[model samples]
Target chain A: MNRFASAITAFALAILAMGAAPVAAQQATPAVTLEGLVKLEKTIEENGKQKVVLEEPKVVVPGDKLLFTTRYRNAGTQPVDNFVVTNPVPDAVRVADESALREQVSVDGGKSWGRLADLTVKGEDGNPRPATATDITHIRWTVPVIAPGASGMVEYHAIVR
Target chain B: MKNARTPLVLGALAATAIGSTQASAAGVTAGTLIQNTASASYGSGSATTTVSSNTVTIRVDELLDVAVSALDAGSVTLADTAVLSYRVTNSGNGNEAFAINVSPTVSGNGFDAAVQTIAIDTNDNGIYEPGIDTVITNGGSTAELAPDAAARIFVIVALPGGTADASASQVRVTAQALTGSGTPGTSFAGQGQGGGDAVVGATTANANALGALLASSASVTLTKSFAILDPFGGAKPVPGATVTFTIQAAASGSGTVSDLRVTDVIPAGTTYVANSLTLEGAALSDAADSDAGTASASGIDVAIGALPGGNSRTVTFKTTIN
Candidate 1:
């Protein structure tokens, strides 16, 4: 009888010890943590200082060539991909130098693009013929992608029609 | 056995509860875990845009200016006869269309009679034609002018110089723009629209000679009269008795009288007596009287010069009869 009692008590103690061990192990496991913060820094400065300078200022003449240039900088910490830039020509001016860019002409204010030589509309005769360069008043550029902290440039020309 | 089983189950349940509480506490305290960091920044970049424009203004450089010199003859001055010259020019960036018209202000000015036939020498032919020299009055009441173009009109003036003074008179000239037309080549077009004088004055009598006068004359005439009076009738002479006789003379004329003289002659039968004698209303005590043989006839002469028209003078004398 005495031996059996002692054996039963030892068995209960063993079961309890096993359960406690799993709880202790769970408590001992290190926890993962996450935190976040946002900051901004801004500054501006004058480009140059000169008493007097002679500049022609851009002008659009009837038969003169028109030029446009655009420059952009990443100015951020992340890489940018699939960048695009668009420009619309003034109504009073017409595109003359179509080959200046991977040129695409937009007759309808940039709603769509087509080759400067392929854009066409139905005439009074209901014939589909290529539109004149004078009909193109807008242009757009699509660059596949741009890396972070980097810059890109584009240029084109048009004649005052 | 049931009691023992109950204690064991209670202990197991308590241990499980404590474990769940601890696990919940750890879960609640665990904040957000950060695996990687990302940053995007925008700059305050500046862009400046400028625009420039050019302008051009058009003005009237030269205009047609006309004036009438003068009119003479039996007929009235006509507008058509009053030829006017003008000059037109392109004073602006582009060409423009212009029209001209001349209307009479007063019909008596003989605008119609003087300008019987109107002509425009577009080709300088000196002849009148339909298209070459248009008659704007025939179509509707308007005239046409081309850009930078000039023209002149000749009018006849039916002047009546023979009736009145054969002097010339001035004629007024005015102009206006036709419908839907620009200003004429001449500056006078559309002038005086506010009822004011537009034409400048030109004088023709600036170099004429002065006048002169001829023959003139004047005349004069004279007349004279005399009167005598007796102070007493014919009576025998008595000693110390005195009688008076009066004599008067007057001169009248339209001419000047000078160096006049009067004389009284005593009759031979009369006795010589003397008190005093006066000659020409002047006392003359020193002169001898004709009544006295010792006294000579008393007389005097008066002198005058340059008497004007319608004038007279008088002289008187007195004597005593014995």
Candidate 2:
């Protein structure tokens, strides 16, 4: 191959790689993940800090408090901003007052989220009642910035109804 | 408000307060798998969809509920007709059929009724009107009862005519979910969806009635006494001995009992002595063609007419113990 033809081939390869930027961006993650757990005073020391002993239990009865954790990692070489993660509470269980962090809850299955006081659940009498700790249906968190290669987790507690 | 969640719910907490429970077939129940996919969008790029690595499914499940409307035992009488009404409700979350079987209470004292029949209260008026209501075909599966709905059952029991006075007998009626009648810890399959529901009722709903003796003020009392006479004219209970059974109907109440008749079925181990029936000290022929009485190998029947209040009439028949 002549120099001119080799130059054209290299340029075509570069264009093709550029066209596949979105697919590669998706595969090579600045990614987020979510987890669910049931905990009650199950504290464990992790890295010199006491936190809930995360468990994957086989059975859970009424009144059990659950902790949901969402971990986000920036694997790609780029700083990400406006990070947000939302989780819908299990329909049969309710959210507790003290969550792992300050978060918003949704009573309408993640359609909209707000403080617990701003939510409502239709009760047995078919009347709208202020959302109690057990009425929360979804939990959400917002992060202003997540640097490259950095990972963090957000969590909340919900009591089984 | 409606939840477009499009899942059937039979959860007791969310529905009825009774022990009945709810089940959903959206592939989620306690102690069942709950898979949630999570994705994120950031850095002005399309969202990255990743199934949860921090994922878990906390145990949850559905419960089966079967209940009777009545909360108390009922009352009936000896030799009288009684009706037991039970409103069997399916408090569960989906539609299902229930099987019904009735019997004298396993641990009760009431003598079993001679004639007991079960009928569905088709009119929902709680009446067991014959010809109007359809029988459950000797206590069988009910026609498709729906969730949150109830079907009324009428158990008509006729106390055996020969029931002893001042006795109590009870009858029990049981209803079982045909789908979940056996084995605990097995899934109760949701009516519409696949697989099993989380929980099921171990036992079905059963209602019982205590047919206690009301101490009938107008009732007549009968006493039976037997005496054996041997070939040697000595009292004996041995086989081939002549046995005399005296049945005395004494009126103690202040009301006359009309249309009174006396019947004696020969004992299994005894052979009837011909022409040996005495009613009120009058001889009654042991012949089916005889006047005012009929006789057969089974026994003898005599028309005793009426016994006034405070009067006593005695009927005696002789048989040979075989």
Model 2 bad stretches (over 4 Å):
A1-71, A90-103, A108-114, A117-129, A152-161, B1-62, B69-74, B106-110, B137-139, B182-184, B188-194, B201-258, B261-322
Question: Residues A50-94, candidate 2, lDDT per residue (tens digit)?
Answer: 987656543343344556566677765667677766665545555
TM-score of each: 0.26, 0.54
Candidate 2 chain A has its poorest 10 consecutive residues by lDDT at A1-10
TM-score of chain A of each: 0.57, 0.63
The residue-level lDDT of candidate 2 at A53 comes to: 66
What TM-score, to 2 decimals, does candidate 2 have? 0.54
What is the lDDT, from 0 to 100, of the residue B210 in candidate 2?
Answer: 33
Report lDDT (Cα) of residue A87, candidate 2.
Answer: 60
For candidate 2, give the lDDT of residue A119: 72
Give the per-residue lDDT digits (tens) of candidate 1, residues B25-120.
001001111011111112112311111111111111112222222122233322112332222221111112233333323433311222233344
In angstroms, the error of model 2 at A11 is 44
Candidate 1 residue-wise lDDT, A1-161, digit = tens: 32443354356446645744664464342111112221111122447643422223121112324344555555444444444444444332345655423476665545668887667654447787676665554565555544555676655554322
- Name the top DockQ candidate: 2
